[model samples]
Target chain A: MMTALLVMIGLALLLGIVLGYSALKFKVEGDPLVDKIDAILPQTQCGQCGFPGCKPYATAIAHGEADINQCPPGGEPGMRALADLLGVEPKPLNAECGTPKPKSVAVIVENLCIGCTLCIQACPVDAILGAAKQMHTVIASECTGCELCLPPCPVDCISMVPIPEKVDNWKWRYPVIEIKSLAV
Target chain B: MSLFKFHGGVHPPEHKLKSTAAPIRSVTMPLRLVLPLRQHVGNVAKLMVAVGDHVLKGQLLAAPDGMISAAVHAPTSGTIAAIEERLIPHASGLPDLCITLNADGEDRWGDHQPLDYQAQEKSAVLDALRLAGVVGLGGATFPSHVKLRADDAHPVLTLIINGAECEPYITCDDLLMRERALEIVRGIEIMQYLLGAKHAIIGIEDNKPEAAAAMRLACSQNSISITVATVPTLYPGGGAKQLIKVLTGLEVPSGKLPTTIGVQCFNVATAYTVHRFIDHGEPVISRVVTVTGRVAQPGNYEVPLGMEIFDLVQAAGGTADDSNGLVMGGPMMGFNLPSGHVPVVKGTNCIIASAPALFAPQPPAMPCIRCARCAEVCPVNLQPQELYWFARADNFEKARSYDLFDCIECGCCSYVCPSRIPLVQYYRYAKSEILASDKARQAANVARERNELRLARIAREKEERAAKHAERAVGARAEAGGDAKQAAIAAAMARAEAQKAEIVPQNVTDLSPLVATEIKAIDARRGKVDDRD
Candidate 1:
């Protein structure tokens, strides 16, 4: 009986040492929880979530200091995705932040553009191309439709326009009806 | 040879006799032709002719833009009227870039030479096919040259010719086979030579006994060891995968091509086109389109590409008074066209003029009774009801997990659904949504990468500026005096700190005042705790 008890204690001690060694051997460098939360948040960097960027908001959420519903640009779907990842109940998007809107990309009216660089600086994706005192244009394909550049245009030349659907971009519309020949 | 059978399929009514009963006739040339740049899938062909330029018949109008695109040729000698947005054949009824040409009626030919495939290198033959605007004529309109190109990994074994023509009211292939069997056999020989395939099989439906007999006779006359295997007549048995399954007993895995399994499939009409282009010095400027349903004279016509469907329908004795709608393909798989004015594209196989009595109006869709009849007829063996539920709810992830993309949009599920639910439409909606979202996600990733690079560039620029300032200050301090070295260092350190404070990335927004205050408070509380410890 004494020998069996001693063997059990010895096995427990060895397992504990191995577990401690493994903990140090393969340690992850950064906070993976923050990374996962950041992945769930839309990287709009619009500051509509009251944080500096998506990363900061994600970090705040990881630290238990921020609610998961603070993101407005992410909308309810984004909130639910985050809630699923964080194992929490999804809450309604915080009204203190901006309301969700349809995606719109910034379009600069070249004739009205005052050649100011403020809008260019405000763009998070660096999608605007122009020099000072020259006409600026937004690369539509690259623009995230974030609407962040609108506030920085001193001349109000920048406008958020909904992306137009082309023939190729169109999805099949529903409720197809079948018509047969009556005179046959 | 024995034939293999596929899992699930439906046998739709074959009304092919309405058109195939007569011989194929050439349509009268329309006044103008409107050719869309994006006729054969892939990227839109780049325009090679400008407005007002006169082009001859078979003149290259648009060059292939990329590897997967097909070239566009003028259907007849004409003056380029306009290169503007015009309505083309599509489900959406939207306008896109098209070339409008007014035919001069002379039918003048362009400078061209027929290629001797046997004498030329394999690569040369493939290149000629690409230059001649050859593509699969089996509705998908994929570039044919890409399929014929030899792959080192999957050595070709069997080449399957799709003569099944399973869709009801579509008999263009059947007529082409009965008329041009020898030409198709020659094309098959050329494909076999190009692919180095050991065997070739022509798969036709049992309903087309004449076509099968003619093809078999042609195969024997040419001494080409091609087998004409007749598959069971079923809706979508004509599909590349289903035909492959039926002929070779091979199930092309989901998300893979037949070429990956040592096989390649092509439409018999595509084979005929290739033969014409290679042997007769012609480009694909026209194809045989079946015009039936509600017309006085329903028959197959060799219609020129870019001929408006209205002209084709009018050539078929025009639509009857009872006709209310037009469908571009067969009754089962076709979409309703908004107008007959849309130009005939490379993929226009059949046009059906619909009337209230011919295609009886469906009752309002009743709720699915969980009867699972749709699942029974799905050619891809997908749970159509489950897919319908997920698609209607906009839960695309679940739909994707259920293999939504595997659906070939054959309309078998929709055709068999007792509730009259448009199951294929829902699946199409889901598939398109998934594709669009995938594209959006790709764009987002690109933007993210660009944003990261911008931040890195800003940091680097700030560092360079700080280094330049420090260098100038050091030079100034050294030139001033050795005794003022410590003061100079202190001044430089303060300036560097200030520069660091000012050099913030533009993409990162400033924190809100409330959050900033809260963060500061937390930091202070942590400091106090550390002190107490």
Candidate 2:
């Protein structure tokens, strides 16, 4: 009985070592999904989707905890691309999170003057650069259009004007209905 | 094998008892009614009567243009106040054409007849459905007439009646089954005959035992071979695929339908409407709706089509202070209405007025940790995380490879996501975006085709003019016919001018063929595409 027990113990240890070695040998390598998801993101560096940046959001999408609809900047197209990537059926944008509004940036009224720096602090992407108690102006370039600056403006001067459809901003509209063959 | 439990189905507290306990009641129609033009799926009905023209209830207000379309009927006898654009019952608060009527207060019916629906030919029954403008009221809003008219070879063996009111806070179907089970059964028989199905199975969720019992009893005396089977309580059991699966243990193959598996599915209300449509020749103008949630007397009410939702809200003891989000249909798959002012269309199932307390605020989305919960809950086995990652990367080419279209947008993924990610919303956005891009491509293609045709026409005209000039020159060469040739040349010039004038309007009409011909041409084009190897 002692000999049999000893043999069994030895076999178990050997199997464990083999399994450990095999696991080390056969690592599945890096994931391609995270890289793909990260690529689709606008790279605004805004944490509007609750992820710290685009990379974290992409990772969450790969892991399945987050939905592709969380990012407002990506809009409908981004959501659809993510849905397609995730192999899920696409649905309408959840109005609760918000609708797909045109890309807009906050324009602070230069004359509203009392720059308490509240708008700067509220800016998710650090789009606005202003000092405390100084006459502040909006640096339109970095504005992610999350409207975070609008709420903090006690004077209600910051407004989101739509970005014009320029050649650079223009995207082709996708097809609405799938063309099916006519069967008589 | 944990009973195929899917990810992302929310366990919303059933507030069904508010109206479930009460019987179905007929609501009072106000002094006015407004019927929308594009209520059902397919092309909007063409208005038959002009403004100020009087119409009776159940009267054909609009006529169908084609086989795929449905006719619109007047809900009540009234003077046409206006045929104008109004906010349509849609998730995206958009406006659509509507027929406004100042009710003369006389709810009158037009000419109609009853028939042994089985004796009537399938074509005639389909005509009845089309004439009545019958559409699936179970959120799909598909033309009922079109659904029954499947291809010659695709034989329907079983008619599956969907009674799975699995969505929380919606008991309209339940109340309908309990109150008018006989009518529904009769409608089911009509559907069975319409589709030439051998047997009929009514699949009701186990939650509505009372409804199931009532349906069973109603079909007891009927000659139709109707069987009522109780399905396990699941959120989307009401979906066409899920209901058919539960009833027959059959899987509708990917990219196929229940009809392909010899099964035809219809909502319970649609079945009831079918009976009225076939038997009495009454067009579907209105439907029974459940007005409940955050209001005082919440229950099922028979409301007219295009009736203002605010009217019902008022009749149901008005909206309470807590009614923040007013959603149309059930909690899970329903759409949020911009305001309650939007008129009810054929697809409007239920109007819910719930506060944030009921539907809690969403927290920030956290990173996914490679959990396979989404895969486990997916009714269709799909790698959701992988797809999500690809979609986020804007790699649609790779996403298509994953079969994105097969995702049903059932909200199962969104419901179960611990990170509170609106997964379904993302999918919708992606689909719309893809669709929009595809549309742009198609429009471009169409423009290119039109340009090519215009160029060809110009070349042909140029050739014809040159030929006419050559003919005139030849005639002038024949001796003293120079004067006649000159006259002929002048006439030819005049004729050419006339042809040029004709090309503008005549060819413009020729550009877009008659609506029917255009539909036919579109179908023909589709056939060519399908015939492609």
- Candidate No. with top lDDT: 1
Worst 10 residues of 1 chain B by lDDT: B504-513
Measured against the true structure, the TM-scores of the candidates, in listed sequence, are 0.89, 0.65
Docking class of 2: incorrect
DockQ of candidate 1, scored on C-alphas against the true complex (2 decimals): 0.49
Cα displacement (Å) at residue B391, model 2: 4.0
Q: Report the C-alpha lDDT of model 2 over A1-184, residue by residue, as the tens digit.
A: 9999999999999999999999999976777888788766665445667776567778888998877788766678778877877789876665555556776777888888587988876654455777988877766765556676777688998889997653222343321333567899
Taking the tens digit of each residue's C-alpha lDDT, what string does model 1 give over A74-177?
79988998999989998998999979987778889899998988888888888999999999999988887778888888889989898777787887765556
- iRMS values for every prediction: 2.0, 16.5
Top of the candidates by DockQ? 1
Residue-level lDDT tens digits of model 2 in B1-533: 01233323335467888888678777787777778777777777888999989888888888887766778888878889999877777755666778888888868877777756678677876887788888898988888888898557789998989998878888999999998999999999878877888899888888899999999999997987798988778777778877777677778887887788898899999999988877777778778788888888898888888788888788888878977867898878887787777777788889887778777766666776667676666666666776666666666656667877678777777677776666666556656556655654453344334333544666899999999999989886775567887899899999999997887533334445576588778889998998993
lDDT (C-alpha) at residue B49 in model 1: 95
Question: In candidate 1, which residue ranges exceed 4 Å CA deviation?
Answer: A1-5, A174-184, B481-533
TM-score of chain A of each: 0.85, 0.65
The number of the candidate with the highest TM-score is: 1
Q: Which stretches of candidate 2 lie over 4 Å from their true place?
A: A1-184, B1-12, B461-533
